[model samples]
Every structure is written in structure tokens, then in C-alpha cells.
Target chain A: MFEALGLMVFYENMLALNNVSLACGDNQIVGVFGANSAGKSTLMYTLSGIMEDIAKKELMAGGERITLRGSINYKGRDISHDKPSKRAKAGIILCPERRRIFPESSVLENLKIGGYLAKPAQAAETLEYVFKIFPPLTKIVRRLGGFLSGGEQQMLAIGRALMAQPKLLLLDEPLLGLSPAIQYWLAKSIKEIAEERGVAIIVAEQYARPIMPIIDYGYILENGSAVVEGDKDELMNNPDVKSAYFGA
Target chain B: MDILIYGVINSATLALMALGFTLVYGVSRLPNFAHGALYVLAGYICWLLLNRLGLPYILAIALALGLVAVVGGAMYQLILVRIRGMSISEIIASYAIGLAILEGLRWGGLKGGTFTLPAFLEGSVDIAGVSVDFQRILVVVLGALLVGLLYFFVNHTRLGLALKGMAQDERAALTLGIDSDRMAVASMALGSLSAAIAALILLPLGSIVVEAGYHVLIMAVAVCIVGGLGSWTGAILASFVIGFAQILTTAYLGAHFQVVVAILAIILTLILRPSGLFGKQKELEERV
Candidate 1:
């Protein structure tokens, strides 16, 4: 299991996340649900080693104690000191919110860059895999990223990340600003990515409606803290979650 | 007519250097004010090797270009890379380094006495019935070739397209796993290399001086701004416009005010077409 214990992250004067701890196994898809400004992104950032903080950290794969303080532990290895690029090479990739597609580049160039850390030949194969998942991208490989519609760009963004062949995919608000149809399309794609690739996922979203059913485990965040954490079904029906998210 | 041809030739060289400068800025989001120093230093280095070390012309030029690339790469790593988070300050600091380089070259050149290089190609060629220096033809041809190659590189090649992608969205580029640092270094080296080529061509135009790059530096800046900073074609067209202006001003207004006229033209362009003659609003990406 990959986990974080008693993690606290601060960005300057802002307490972005406080005392957060979570765990997920390779077979489980962990969903992070919170309202806007509930520190969902910060939690993901802290766990991904993109956030700096002061905390007593301990991460363990099975029984052995691993020091993951102010860092991320991937597969019993402390990847805290690794740069984001290196961490990415180690199969830990963040798709990030907003679907940050290099808008001036062609769609193919976007995918080519995703496989940049891997062997060039392997990267080409990965590019083909990415294209297979998003076939529309194959036709528009020459089209600039900026010219694509929002839905296309999001698909391209996720497709680009998939090119890395990540073991742990940290997706931050993949559905943000997307139309309902596109959102569902992406949600299905994410499920397919998880099941077909056997990639562990930590998807942070504002609501559980679209994502919770597919997740094996879940955490409910409120004001920079995880208030309710449990199995997806248990957390979905929890009273606090209903009151917070559904406003019931 | 000869002077006008010279202006056209010189402007082509300016456009060449400015194109590189603009590309570096577009991709790296840094002004690269050290570009002027790169131009002047390349000329000085080439002159040193050719005249002092007695090296062949092509060898000297190629060696100078290679040196600038190394120095440029090192400079970016040592200074710009560390301050990637500091955008405005980096631009200002690069200019400061450029000033320092200009001062050093001026001081060194004065102490060492006059510096000069024999024409690499030598003699004059008829361009549109005008008696043009062969080096002028070489400069134009080389400049066009470099621009064409650069266009292909950015438009067609893997690395060039990658760079263009980086220029579009740095964060997105990083997410794609493009090593932004490596791209930055390569862009800086190429920028310096472009300037180095300009220096090689410019050196034979006149005797070397410490402040020789100042005029060209200003021209580079003006051309970039007028060409629509990120547009390659824009830079080329703007270079010709400035080149013709320089020639006309030198003929009618005199040498003293040639630069002043050029500066005025830039100002006029800025006032009239802020996005540049070729600058479209769409090419600009969101960055602070």
C-alpha cells in the first residue's frame, strides 16, 4: 500500500493542507471529494511530493517502516528527493487540473513529449497506445493544441499522461470545466485506463456523483482536512458527505 | 545604390540575429539581453582566430559559433536557469551581463589596438546591377539559409516542434515530460549561435570596436519588436523594413542620424501596430 501519515503542507502563509493521511492499494481507485477551496488539490500536491511541509512522516509498503516525511514513497522507495521529472520517470505522473495541454503544439507533439522520459523506441509504442485510446487524436495529430476544443484538449491531456505508462496516476479535477457529456466520456476513459492498465489512481474531484461509483476507496475533505474516510459505498452514504456535498 | 545595398545586407544580418533572439524569447520567455554580447564576442573571437591565430576563415567562423553555443549554454545554466522563477529580474540581469561584456570588449580592444579580418569571400558581386560586396551576398544567402533551416526545425523537426510546444505552454510542456531545463539551454545556445553567425558576417563590414554591437543590438531589439516578437516571418520582413530605412536615412539624413531614424521608425511602428506587422493575437500564451 502507498500511504501518507500525519502530513502537513503550507505554502507561505497559507495552510494548504493539515495533518492529512491516506492509503490506497494497486487494486483500489481512491477518490478525493471536497467542496471548492477544501484543500483537495493541496492534499494531492502534498502526496505527490509537489508540496513542501513540516510533518512526522512514515510510509510502509507491508510491515517495514519507510520514512516519507516531506516526500512521496512509491513502491517502498522514498522518492522525496527526486525532482518532478525524475519522479515522473519512476512511473508517478500527475495529469493536473485544467488539462494543461501545450496549446501551440500539435496533438502528436503533446504525446511525444509525454513519453520523453522513457526510451525513444518504447516512447513510440506508448504514443501508439495513446493514439489508440483517443483515435480522434490520430486524425488531428497535426492540429495545434490551442485550436482544439476543450473536450479534445482534455482527452489529449490524459492521453499525454498515459504515454508515460504511469503506475500511479494522480488526476486532479479531470472533469473541471468540461461539459456533462465530455465529463462522462472522460470518466469512462479513466475507468478503462485504471482497469486495462492496472494503474493505481488518486483522483481528486469536487463531487462524488461522477467518480464515487467507480472508486474502491474514498476520502472526504473539508477545510484542509479529511473529515470522513472509508470504503467508497460507506463514505458515499455517510451523513456528513450528504450534508456537505449534496446540501441535504 | 551601393550604400542602399549595404544597408539591405546589414539589415538581413540584423534580422537573422533578431530572429534567433525572438525565438529564444518566445520559447524561453526570457529577453536574452546577453544576445548582443554573443554577437560582438563571436566577431572578436573569429577575428582573433583568423588574424592572430592564423586559422582559415571557415574554421574560425565555425569555431566561433561552437564557442558561443557552449558559452551561451553555460551562461543560461549558471544564471538564467537558477532564476527561472524570476522572470523580469532575469531579463534585466541578462542585459547587465551584456553591458559588462560590451565594456570588457571595449577595454580589451582599446588596449590591444585596432582589430580587423580579411574578407572571407572577398571582392564584389553585382546584385540587381549594383556593385555589392561578395560577403554581402554571402551574408544574405547564409541568413536566408539559416532562417529556412530554423523554420523547418521549428515547423517540422522533433526538437524544434518540442521547443515551439514549450514556448506555447511551459507547464503543459513539463507535464508532457519535456525537460524544460534542457530545452531552455538548447534555445539559449541556438540564440547565441545565431548571434555568432551575425558577428561573423558583421566583423568584415568594418573594424572591430568594443561598442560595435550596440547599434546592432538596438537593431536586433527593434526588429524583434517590429516583427511581432514571436513571429519568424515577421522578424524577416521587419528586418528588411529597418534595413531599407537605415540605407535611406544614411543617404538622405546622414550617418549621424541613421540610428536615430531607425529608432523613430520602431517607435512609429509601436505606436501604429502594437502587435507588430505580423503579430497575431493568438500566438501569445497566458504567462505572467
Candidate 2:
């Protein structure tokens, strides 16, 4: 289980995430939905500790002054000040937006690279499971990651993250720019991965229709704050959620 | 036959000189201007171990390489680690360190043509109709073997693969628990080892001098620029191109024109293809 309390992030004078708290129980799929600039990515980055890295880099480069005030607790241990690599070693992996696959590396190599923290036996087993869950990756195993289609790249990205053996996987816009069919299929696969692998997932997306069915609990983010937090049926019945997300 | 034999020999020498520079830049994007200093330091250490410490030739070489690797790693941990992510500062700091090392060696009496490493083997062999010294032949053999070994290491080993991943995407690698600073240190050590190996084999053909350090730096930079910075395959190919060019320039024009050919190659590559032959960063930027 993972819990974040009173998360606030600011870039100079602009607030990216304001007083947002999120929690993910074991073997549960939590969805955070919002339109553009709703702080979905900011929330994910802050959760995965990448925001700390960005803040460091920015400060070093004298670019921006980023302030982060939050406490991230993973099963009672506070990982608020942990570096991104340390967080990943603690089994918190982020499958970033745009499927940032190593474009030059082969599909298999990308997956292998993702297994940097796993033991040999664990890596091998997870690699096999990745290919099993995303069978299309098996067909183009030798293809360069950049050459793969968007759908295949997304699958590879998820598979690559799975290779990291994450306890809490963060999927940020996994279906962005994807066709409706592939989006539905990926959503289904995400559900199966949670149920089968028992790995907790927190997915942040703008398109809610496809992801809404699979999530047990969801948060609707507007601006930089959580506007609504409820189970699936409650959200579907809400008039504002209906028009904004489902167009009902 | 003479051109063919000499061209291959020249190509191998360039390859050996540029390998460490490329490796450092490839993994961590560190220019490592001290690469040449490390090369010269390795030779001096080998000389010291052999003469002053009364060690055997093989043992001296091995110890010298190990020392250089430690020094290289320490340099990263102590200094380069602070100024990382700033390219200009990294280059300035590294170049300053390189200057101190080279000049310090000169101040300590590393000059003169007296310091020469013994050839690994003593005999001339004929390739085609051209006769070449055993030392030059050793350079070619060792160069090819190093390249092959490096290829295998980067593609097959876990640390090497993690380094490759870091090279491609630092953030993505970080998300997989590959610490960038640790990889940078590892790469520096490996690069230093490579420079020492190159010195052990190549310094036998000529005396070790401080000037050779600066020369090696310029030659490595030239080869990297033409080959496309941080690209291994491109570096090897560009070495062959510039190697043959330098050899042919020396053959026809004058021996002094050899360095001119290298400088010309750098300028031409920059003007025509700023990204070098195999560099994809610029191309990707264009697409985006």
C-alpha cells in the first residue's frame, strides 16, 4: 500500500499541485482523471520522486526554483526525500508519458535494461511474464523501440516497467494518442495485470471513458486539486462527471 | 602494398587513442579532457613500476592499469561529480586537471626521449609485400581485440547494458534504478582502463613524452568529431578514414602535414554534418 499526504508542488510562482492527497491499496487500480494542465502528470512525477530529480536539475541549471512539500509513505516507511533511483529500487516505477522507450535499443534490450534492479532469476521470470502479458512484443522483439508503432511502443513501455518488478506502478497517460480499440485493449490488460500480478497501479489519464470501467476507486482532478473522489458507480451517476467524462 | 599496410596500422593507432574518449562521452556525456593525461599517466606509472619498483613487465603493466582506473574513478567522485550537467564547466574543469597532470609530469622530468617502453615482441613481419615492425602489428591486433571485447561487453554484460540504457535515456534508466552518478564513475574507470591498455601497446613504438599527451587529446577529439561524438561504430570507421588520410598526407605531401589532415577532417565534419556521421540526436531534434 502507498499513501501520499498533503502534496503540494510549485514551479516559481505557479502551483502545479495544490494540497492533493492520494492513496493506493494493495492489488487495487486507482485512476486519477483530468483534462489538460490538471496536474495529473505533476502528481505522478511527484509520487515517483522524479519531481525531486527535476527540481535538482533545474536548481543546478539555475532555471527554476521548484518547491515540493509532501510526504510519500510506502507501507509505513516515509520515502518523501528519496531520490528517483532509490524510489525505483524500492519498487516504485513510473511508466512515463509518451512511452519514453530507448529509441535506438532493440525491444528486448529495452526490457533487459529495465531489469537493472532485479536479481537474475527474478528478471528472467518477469521478462517471461512481460512477454506473456503483451504477446505482441514477442513478434517484434528485435525491432528498435523507436520503429515500433504507438500501440506496440506503449505495450513495450508497460512491459519494460513490469521488468522493473514494481510494487506500485504509475502509468501516466498510457492511452494518449492511441486508437480507441488499442485503448480498450490496454485498459483490459491493465486490469488483468493488477488482478493477476497483484501489483498496485495508479493510472493518470485525460480520457476517462476507457479507464473508468476498470478502476475500483477514482479521483477527478480539476485545475490542481481533486474535485471528486468516489467509487465507479457514484462517479458514473454524478451529473458533472457524466457530461465532462462520459458525455451521458 | 605499402599504403595498405601502413593505412591499417595508422587506423588501429587512431582507434586505440579514441576508444577511451568515446567511451567516457558515450556513457556519461562527459568530455573527459583529462583522457590524454590519463594515457600519459598510465605510461609513466608503468615505467615507474618497471624500473623503480623492480617489477616484471607484465605485472607492471597490470598494476599501472589498475592505478589509472582508480585515479580516474576518484577524479569523478571528487571533482567531476560536483560540476556535472554543466558542459562548459565540465570541460573547463577536466581540461584544467589534464593540464596540471601533463605539466606536473613535465615538471617532474618526464621530458626528453629517454623514456621508452620495450616492444611486446621483437621481430618484423611481412603483410603482402610490405614489411612492418612487430610493434605496429601488435597495435593492429590489440586494437581489433579491444573493439571486439568492448562490443561484447556493452551488449552482453548487465552493467554494460545498464550503461547503454543510461546513454540512451538518463531518466528512463533512473526509473529502472540505474543511478547516473554511479554509472558515470564506472564509465570513467572503464575509460581509464582503456586508455592505459592503449598506452601499454602503443607507447612501445615511440618514447613517452608530455607533448604526446596533448597530441593524443587532439587526435582523439578529431576522430570523435569526424566519427560523430559518442558513437562507437562511427569512431572506428572515422579512424580508418582519417588514418588513411593522415598516412597518405605524410606519404605524398610532408610528414608534418599529418596533423593538418586531422584538423581538416574536424573542420570539414563540423561544417558539413555538425552531428558527425552516426550522431542521431540532431536528427531526432529535427523530426520533433
Candidate 3:
């Protein structure tokens, strides 16, 4: 479960997400469609507590607050106030944009660090679980992330996030920079992660068609706000959504 | 044969110092200028415990190392941590602080008083017509063992892997739930601790002086730069190369020019191969 009440975030003097609010029930895949610079990444960063200090002060001043922001609850006990590390322990893991894999480290090393969120003992089981989802990763676990092809690095990044056993997974532009074939494969894997694990997701993306098959709900982020929100069918056919996002 | 044995000792010493330097730079991305302070402090601490306090040799050594570890850790947090997100000024300030500490010890000691190591193992051992001091041999063996242990700790243990990950990408490591500040402190402690060990071996080599850490630290900078900043393998290989170069220079040109030649070598390496002999070029795409 995830909820953002009037969640407003901003970078210095510029509003990114203004009074933006959304909610996702357990295991729901909520796809956020927006043009470039629509604050999708900032929204994900704020939700995951990775919002930098510069943007954090601006967002707090912009009167935007994340209420009950994590998997636990929305009223008060939520991890909105928790540090990034604590939030991760609370199972609010984010697969950041650009993959953000430790480039110099091996694939296994990246996965191992992700496993540190819980405990060392659970690593083997986590590794096995992750490998089941992305078997290609198991073969290249020893290779450095920098050496991995773009598609492979994306897999490793998402797989590393899975190793954390996140209850609420935030995928930021997973399909960005991916080829059509690889994008299809990654979308399938992401759907499986959300469906099989019941891991709630809030993915931010420019391309909506690839994620439309898996996403239960959709929110269209306009200039600085979520101008439209509904079930996939309703929002997919909305005139504004079609023109601004799908270029229909 | 004697020259070769001396070269081995030289290599071992250079490796020991470079290990500490590289460990600090690897994680912090800043060359810890205070590391030399730790080195010089280690010797002074040992001297005070052994000669002034009249403690037994073994006890003194342990106390000195433990003391330096605590002091090093604290100083890193107080001074180094203040400049955590700042620019290269942190490194410059750290070096200044280190120099200040060394000079303070010297000035505090009244006209750079004599510094000497406790006569732990003074005898010499002759091997195949090559006479080497027992202490120097011990330093070589013990240094190798320490470096080996450090290598194992960094490469084998889970905590070590976490630490190496932090060095690789601090933000990503933190996102994985590793407390990066804790890792940094631990890394600094280990780096300073290694400096302490090198100081222990360095005691017999020369008299104790605050300035004693200066040259050794300079040598470490050369070795680390030549090897590569974050590459442990590079640091080790460069240490051997520099160590042999130093010995050859000392034997042929004389001791006074050894330091100059080493400095020249570091500048040349920095110019020729800025990425280091073994280090990868820094990826500029991340900042964008």
C-alpha cells in the first residue's frame, strides 16, 4: 500500500510536483506518465527518501508533505520521516533512474550490497529468488556492472532492488534507453515482480504503451501536477492524456 | 645479494605505507593528509610508552597502536568529516593539520630532540655473505603478512565488501542501506591502524621526530599515485617498483637524491598516466 497526500516537491525556486497526490492499494502497479522534466523522478525520489537536501528544503517550503508514505501506514507510523537507509529497511526500495548500479563492482557484489538491507543470512535465498526472475543475471554475476551491456545493467539494477525484498517498489523509467525487444522482456519481468510478489509499484515513464499492459492505474503528470488519474482504460482514452502523452 | 635483500625491505616498507594511503583515498575520495600525522604519532606514542612510561616492549606497541587508532578515528570525524561534502580543500586542510601535528610535536619537544627506537632486535643475521639486520628482516616479513591480512579482509569478509562498495559508489552503497558514515569511520580506523603498524616497524629505522612522518608520507603519495588511486593491486605493484628504484638511487646516487628522484617519478607518472598504471578512468557521465 502507498499513499501521497498533497505531496509537493520542488528544486530551488522551481516547483517540480505541486500538491501531487496518489494512492496505490496492495500489489497495484501505478504507472505515472509525464513529459521530460515533469518531476516524475523527483516524485520517486521523495517517495523513496532519496530527495537531496537542495530539493528537500524547497519541497518542505512548498507546503508538500508525504503522509503515510511507505508500506507500513499513511497516518503517522509511515517511513516518510525516516532516513533512506531506514526506509530501505522498511522495504521501500527504489530502482533509480539510470540504473545507478555500482559500475566498478561485479554483478554479484551489487546484489550482495542490496542484500545488506535485511541480513547476510538471507542472501543466498534472495539471490536464488532474484535469479529465478532474471536468469540472465546469474550468468554475469561475476562481471563488473560497467562492462555489462545496457540491457544487462538494467536487469542487474532491477534485480539488485528485488534482493532487498521491497514491499513497495518504485521503478523510475525502467524502459528508458532500452531496445524494443529488451523493453518487452523487462516489462514482462517487472509485471511478474509486481504480480507474483504483490509488490506495490509507482513507475514513472514517458512511454506508456509498454507499461500499459501491466499497470492497473495511471496518472498523467502535467506541467507541475497530476492533471489526470484513473484506471488504465479511462486514463488511456482521456483526450488530454492521448494528445499530450501518447501524441494521438 | 645484499642490495637485493635491501631492495626487498624497501619494497615491503613502501607497500606498508601505500596500503594505508590507498585505503583512505579509496573510500573518502580525498587523500587523508592527517595519515602522516597518524604515522608520526604512532612512533611518538610508542616512544613515550616504551621509554618514558617504562612499559614493556610488547605492551607499549599494543598501547601505541590502540591509542593511534582511537585518535585517528576521532580526528577523522572531527576534522575530515567537517569537509565531507566540500571540495579538495578538505584534503589540503588535512595535510596542513598533519604537518601542524608533526611540527607541534617537534616544536613541543624543544629544538627537534633526538628520537630513537627501543632496541628490540639489534642483532644482524648473515645469509649467503649478505648481512641483514634481524629487525629489518622481521619488518619485511611482518609487513607482507599485514598486507596479506588486509587484502583478505577487504576481499573476503562481508563488511569488507560493503566497505569496498562504499568506496566504489557511496550514494549507491547508502541506498543499499549501508551506513556510509560508519563505513568511512571504520575505513579511516583501518587506514590509521595500518599506519600505526608501519610506524612500529619504522621505529628501528631512525630516531623519533615529528618530521619523521613527512618523508614516509611523501613516499606513500608517490606509490599510491603511481599505482592508481583506488586500485590496491596498482598500489602494491607500484610500491615494489618505487621501492627498488629508491634502493638503486640510494646505492648509486646517494641517500640525499633518493627522495628527489621519487618525487620526480610521481610527477612523471601523474603526467604520463593520470588514471594511474592500474586505475580506470573516472566516468564523467555520472555527474551529468
Candidate 4:
């Protein structure tokens, strides 16, 4: 339901995203695997229209001249130049890397704040659903977001994004620094969320082993380019992906 | 007993003055130096409506507040939005707007401490054997009420929660569909409204003079700096600290040392704490 065509992002003279194309169908989990500095975060930002904001801020501050060349068609609307809020309202929400939860706000407050665009009834229902999905959050509902563990923060981040009622959720390194057990468990929960909520999820990660089993389709990014793209099984058996990602 | 009674009133006055400045900074990090100008602007507008236009007091206060809110939002929409990422420019632009408003009023015949708004009530009551005017009592009552109302609004309401989110992290707020520009506009309007409220109650104690505008700005900035910029609780607490200090200074070291006390509070906070009470980012270590 969401497709980005020939996405190219340039920071000053360096190409951050070099003519990469990606698409995800409804209710699908698309994993984009890449090592560090492989343009995964850049692509995620470009998709969520955050790059436009960054570009604007940089230009206003007379910093780097960021160049974005792409057409993102979401649900048949060309939203390449829309603001992040506009994109979010259009059911595109990005759960950013590092889980930038409001440090001072309580966990419940963070979730409620995420429901900014939702109607009161929708927000209430989503709050219930979020707690149901992330059970640990229910116990620590009163704890400050800053005090949460890394795994808890990731759950809160995803739950917070779910509160935004996204049809296409962009997960940027959801399991960056988690233990393997939590990573796999969280990956399973992500798949269930996709299947149950019917929201398409695009997870960009460096560690592919945990998320690989849950994704339907995947892309392997290397140095700002998607060098390999295929279904999950095809990717697991591919020679290049195996060597780089699977360590086979 | 006198110092205690007067100290509470003084702190309330300082809190009322700094609330708007801290709020706008809290939500969007926009240092609205025109906060003082807006306070004077509200009083002057109300004076014009009540006297020049012959409107009722209630209607005049309401209309003045509404107009100030519009001006605040418009200031952001027209000028500040254009210079959004640079802090120095934001301060300069806002302070310049403040100068234009205060000096423009001076240029337009708002001179020499003659203009004053009538108090909502006109009687003094003896409180614990001390004679206290009704307007000063009203300032304290309204100030406390405003703080409670503002706390409820920010914590309970959706827009307020959205604003709080924006204050914590702008980009994270963005992904949740909370538009920074829109929230900033809302913050400016709300902040300006608080400034007008302070003007309505406190301006009656003295006069709606242009000099008071600059004085209010200095006092507000001093309170916010000591309280930690963008931290309202810190602002209120710092107000009490500086407020009592100012009152004590006025009582003991002559009234002329009151302003000196406020300025001294700001410098000392910077030297010692640096981030005020609740301010983040300048501390030795922060939350993980």
C-alpha cells in the first residue's frame, strides 16, 4: 500500500540514499537489513517525511544543503513533500531509533501524547490495546519513561507509535541494543502486531537473524544501496546475504 | 507577619510575570522577550477599550486578552516562523517586537504613568492585623488559580499533552502528528494570554506605563533564568526565592535595591547551578 520510487537523498556532496526503491503491501512485514552507515536510517527518515523537516531546519540554520529526489505514493497519494505530521495523519508513523521517549513524562502520558491525532474514543481503545500488547507496560504505567529499561523503552516506543494509529509503521532498528532473547521475543510480537492490527511494518535493522524469520519480504542494504531484494526464504538462502548477514 | 504576608504577594506577582515567558519557552523553546510588551499591551488595550471605546470592564478585559493572543500567534506566523532554528535571531526578533510595541505605545501617547486600569474591586481588608488591598489579594488569588488551571490544562487536556510532548522532544512529537509550528503558535497565544492576565490584575497596583513593560521583562527573565528556562515548577519556586529576597531587600536595604536583588539572583544561579532548578542538559549526568 506504500511505495517509494527511486529515492535519492544527498547531504551536501555525499549521497546518503542512492536511487533506492522500496514498497510494502498491506499487512506485510518488510525487513531492510544493513550494517552501520548503510543509509537505513536515512531511508526511514525520507519515507516518514522527517528528512524534509531536517532539510528545512538545516537550510534555515545555513547548514548542509540536503537534496531529496523521490516520489512516495502512500495509499495512492503523492506525499513526498508533506510534513511529518501530515504523513502521520495519513497513517504513516515512524518509531524512531533509540526510542526517543519523553524523559520527564510518565509512561502513560507518553502513550496519551502519541494519541494526539486520534479521537477520544479511538485513543482510549488504542490505549487498552497497547497495554494488552505490551503487558509489562501495564505494571509500570506510572514510571517515568526515562527510567525504563532498553527493552521496555522499545516496547513503549512501538506502543506509542501504535497509539498514533498507523497503517504503515516504520520501525527503525527496534532491536538495536537488546538481548537476543528480548530481540526475538519482540520480533515475534511485531509480527503478531502486523497480523493482528493489519498494519504494514517496515523494520530496518543490522541484526537480521531475529527479525528474518518473521518478515515476508526483505532487502539487504550496503553503502546506501539495496544490493539484494527477495522473499524471506530466498534471502536466507542467498550467498551474499548469507555471508554478510548470516555469517555462513 | 508583615514580611510573610508581603513575601507571598511578591512571589505571586513574580510568578504571574514569569508564567507566560516560561510556558512559551517550555513548549517551543521560543524566548518570547516580548512577554513584557504583551503584558503592557493587554493593559493598554483594555484601557483603550474601557476608556476610549467606552466598553464595559468585563468585555474590555476579554477583548484585550483575545487581541493579545491574536498578536502573539500572528507574530509567530509572520516573523518568527521565518527564522526558526537560530536562537540568537529568535531572541533578537522577539525582543525587537517587544521594543516596537512598548516604544510604539510611547510614540502613540502612552507616556508618563498616567494610564491605569481600575481594579475589579476597590476596598482593603485587614488580614491578620495588616491592612491589605483587595487588588493585591485578587492578584494572589488569581495567580494561584491560574497556576492550578494551567497545571490541569497541561496535564489533562489532549492539546496540552501534545504541547508537553512537543516540549520534551520535537521530532518524536512530529511522528505522533503533533505539528511543531501549530503547537508553537498555540504556545505563543496561551503564553500571551497569561501575560495579559498578569497585566489585568497587577497593572492596577501601579500603572500601565512603558517603563513597567521593560521592568516586567527583566523580572520575568530573571525568574525564568533562576528557575531554569522552560521549567514552570522551577519558575514558580525561583519566583518565591527571588520574590522574598526582593521584598527583604526593599524592606532592609531601601526599595532601590529590589531590582538589584532580581539581577543578583539570575547571576548567582548561573554561576552556581547554571541550569536553574529543573533545567536539563547542563547537569553532570542525565537520564539514560
For lDDT, the strongest prediction is: 4
lDDT by residue (tens digit), candidate 1, B1-288:
677778768678778768768888877877888888888888888888988899988998899999988888898899877666466778788888888888987777533437776677889867778888887788888888888888888776667766887787665555555667889999999889888877777678777776666776787788878888777778888888888877777788787877786688689888998889877766555421
Every candidate's DockQ is 0.28, 0.74, 0.43, 0.83
Is candidate 2 or 4 superior in TM-score?
Answer: 4
List the candidates ranked by DockQ, beginning with the highest.
4, 2, 3, 1
Write the residue-wise lDDT of candidate 2 on B106-221 in tens digits: 99999899998999999998778788999999899999999999999999889999999999888888888888899999999999999999999999999999999999999999
Give me candidate 4's TM-score against the actual structure. Answer: 0.98
Model 1 chain A poorest ten-residue lDDT run: A52-61
Sort order, lDDT high to low: 4, 2, 3, 1
**lDDT, candidate 2, at B136:** 95
Listed for every candidate in order, the interface RMSD values in angstroms are: 7.7, 1.3, 4.1, 1.1
lDDT of 2 by residue, A1-248 (tens): 79999999999999989899989999999999999999999999899888998999899888999999989999899999999999998889999877789988999999999988888999999999999999999999999987988899899999999989998899999998899999999999999999888899999999999999999899999999999998999988899999999877
Angstrom error at residue B225, model 1: 1.5
TM-scores for chain A over all candidates: 0.87, 0.98, 0.88, 0.99
**How does chain B score by TM in each prediction?**
0.91, 0.98, 0.94, 0.98
Per-candidate TM-score against the hidden true structure = 0.88, 0.98, 0.90, 0.98
Error of 1 at A40 (Å): 2.1
lDDT accuracy of residue A20 in candidate 4: 93
How does model 2 score on DockQ? 0.74
CAPRI band for model 1: acceptable
Residue B113 CA error for candidate 2 (Å)?
A: 1.4
Indicate the residue-level lDDT of A169 in model 4: 96
Tens-place lDDT digits, model 3, residues B77-178: 777766565547677877888988888887778135476776568889888898888888888888889978987887777778778778877666656666
User: Candidate 3: TM-score?
Assistant: 0.90
In model 3, state the lDDT of residue A112: 79
**lDDT (C-alpha) at residue B183 in model 1:** 91
Give Cα-based local distance difference scores for all models: 0.76, 0.93, 0.79, 0.94
